[model samples]
Target: MTALVEVVRSGFVESVHHGSLVVTTPDGAVRASIGDVHSPVYPRSSNKPLQALAMLRSGLEVADDDLALVCASHNGEPDHVERALALLERAGLTEDDLHCPPDRPRHEPAAEPRRAAMNCSGKHAGMLATCVAAGWPTADYTDPGHPLQRAIADTVSEMIGEPIAWTGVDGCGAPLLAYSLTGLARAFGRLAAGTGTPRRIADAMRAHPWLVAGTGREDTVLMEAVPGLLMKGGAEGVHAFALSDGTAVAFKIADGNARAREPILVETLRLLGETPKDEAREAVDRMAVGAGVVTGAGRDVGSLRVTGAVAEALGTGS
Candidate 1:
């Protein structure tokens, strides 16, 4: 692993985060890398877009906005919950069909816990809808041996151009496939290249960024601010994105610290020539501020910043 970010308090370095990152060209060639980008790691929810593509390939059909939700790791807000429920209803199913654990809104405390309110409910709903469309069994949709899951695994493997290194249960209780950051970046490059089914999934996400995540979320905010940028972040500090030109990036923080993610992402995007537009500059700036300030007695003292290899790559080395 390589040092990727630092937490500075009172102008002193207090903590450091290590991670692997890979940048791929439009043709999926490695442009640059730090750490073990070739090793397999569970991509978490970063795999959603690819999974949505797999569902589409399996005959699942939905409106564009609904498709975006199908690829979501939503904030569990009212609109998000309602949309997931609506998808289930369209498939003649209900929240009970969802295997994801019941949970409340991540950003809304007052909401009651329910299966539909779980962040992964949209994905579960999509899986169920795919089952209905493909004549597969919905009750066992989350099972690794289920046809829907098998199809997803196959699609993921095809897109990444490699067999999955391992299989595990995701937080949503669905089959999770592991692959290298390079492979993940390549899959996203193909999506962003705007070709067939993958293009449809990527366009839906780019068209409905809010449904892809939610208000104030990093994925939503960044997609909105950066035109033609299809991005997704996963648990355990995984993140991946592709530019309209097909340039792609994928990374994982070795320590699984979410706070280090944005700083590294922002710097990496800047290094790759992304310029936030004027209309959405403020929002992008807020995200770019990153890990925020460290304070002493409620007064700002220091701040977290990109450092080490990532910093040097951004030409802002400490």
Candidate 2:
């Protein structure tokens, strides 16, 4: 099948393999994508919202404002650092309590704080707090069977409306469930418009868009522009979103190229009726279509497309 979906190039091709996705409200489903959306690829930080669901289940009762940090993949700007610290303090914990790796800030070139954008940091912090409230052990908080993570997996499964078929270690050392792209999309859609856990989590992300990503982040900007949108992006060319109405989208770049993010994201937004066709095109244009790092000298990689059973799933009501 000539896998390793390379974006065509002039006299050469580069490997950029990664998954992508889009999901919409009322059902959380797949509208479009490439590669194996059904594969249980590690969702990375995109799964933060699901993790937040567990904190609530654990009786943390975090204010709506703090919900942003709980569900963010922040840039680790000062504000993000301060908020994360506050979250830890709120739980009667401290920076020493954080279990994620230490790293430079995620927002960058702006004297960003350390590891704040490690999106999982806030989630981890929240979990630690939950443990504190429950008096559980903190040393292995990242373990899948840990009370917090155990609850997180249950919540994730319920949101996706299915049992996880497989599991993997995420970049942040948490359990990553193997989920279908359509299922992942539908899970977000539920957050955007479904009842119970879905709507509760979606509301938190929308109400605190800043906490979902960071200042000037495309996901943050997109949510703000679209209003009440459900969106999240994973590392390695993975993205997903849910419209307030019934729309879901997902994509995986055969080769993981950051340059492919905008076009694919905008395209998915357009498909969900969240963006004007031209606006989508412009967004993709900003991705430097033929830039040296992307496609070679003069070749245009094709736009993202979605197909297969997942298409039928999204089309059912998306």
Candidate 3:
């Protein structure tokens, strides 16, 4: 097993997170692997871009900015909510049509929950819009057997180069699918290479980074600093990104701690022969544990760091 990160306090190892990471080139050659990359895992919201492809394939029509929102797990800032509501309106639907459970906004300086504040609202709106376009029944749109969902499954199958390994309901009540980390990396590579809908979605995300997450978010900050690099982080410690050069990386933090994500990603990008811009590097450092400060009782303490096999893989001293 690979221990991807280690938390240290007072110069002693505290705890460790085990996980898998896979990097692949444009031609699908394995560039690196830190653990059992073949194990199936739920990609969660990282799969949104692929899901948006299904909406496009089903004849859903919307502007590029709207398409980016559909591929977002937005922070529910004012713009995110407004765009989500507009999408529903465009489909001749309302928040009542959204089956996703409303949740409090993820934005800082938090706000109350509303249907438009749900992180998955944009995705749900996309599904509803696709249904409206295809004349599919609006009700039961989340059903696996629903035409829209079935199309999404097919699209996912094609992207991952395999049949569905498992299916479950996401937090938002929509179907979630599982795939290997390597498969996930390959899919992101295709997304970066963008044939059709992926290009539009990628362009929109790059153009409107705020809508993808929010101001000061890791994804937004990184995308802004690194042109042509696309990134998305899923719940439960899954994150994947691809660069214009066709390098892609995907990983899952075994303990599901998000703080480890940026450090691992930054190191992985370095190992892949790419260096982040200063601004992006600063954002990553802010997300990293050892590189950032650890506080206890409002006083500085020891910090977390990467250790174990992943250290060598990333060419960093443990």
Q: How far is each candidate from the true structure, as Cα RMSD in Å?
A: 1.7, 4.7, 2.0
Question: What Cα-based lDDT does every candidate model obtain?
Answer: 0.88, 0.65, 0.83
For model 1, the run of ten residues with the poorest summed lDDT: 284-293
lDDT per residue as tens, model 3, 1-318: 788887777777777888988888886667778988887899999999889989999999999888889988888888999999999998999998999987778755456667788888999999999999999999999999999999999998898777789999998999999989888888888888867777777778778877889876778877887778888899999999998866788999988888778767666655556666775676666565544456677765777676646657655644
Local error of candidate 1 at 95, Å?
A: 0.7
Q: What lDDT is reached at residue 303 by model 2?
A: 29
Candidate rank order under lDDT: 1, 3, 2
Off by over 4 Å in 1: 291-293, 311-318
| Clash pairs (backbone) in predicted model 3 | none
| lDDT by residue (tens digit), candidate 2, 6-64 | 34344344443344443434544343444556666555566777778777887766777
211-292 in candidate 1: lDDT tens per residue? 9999888888888878999999999999999999999999999988888788777777887778877887776665665534
Name the 10 consecutive residues with the lowest summed lDDT in model 3: 285-294
* Model 2 spans > 4 angstroms off: 1-25, 28-35, 109-117, 276-318
Q: What is the Cα-based lDDT of residue 20 in candidate 1?
A: 92
TM-score of each: 0.96, 0.79, 0.93
Most lDDT-accurate candidate: 1
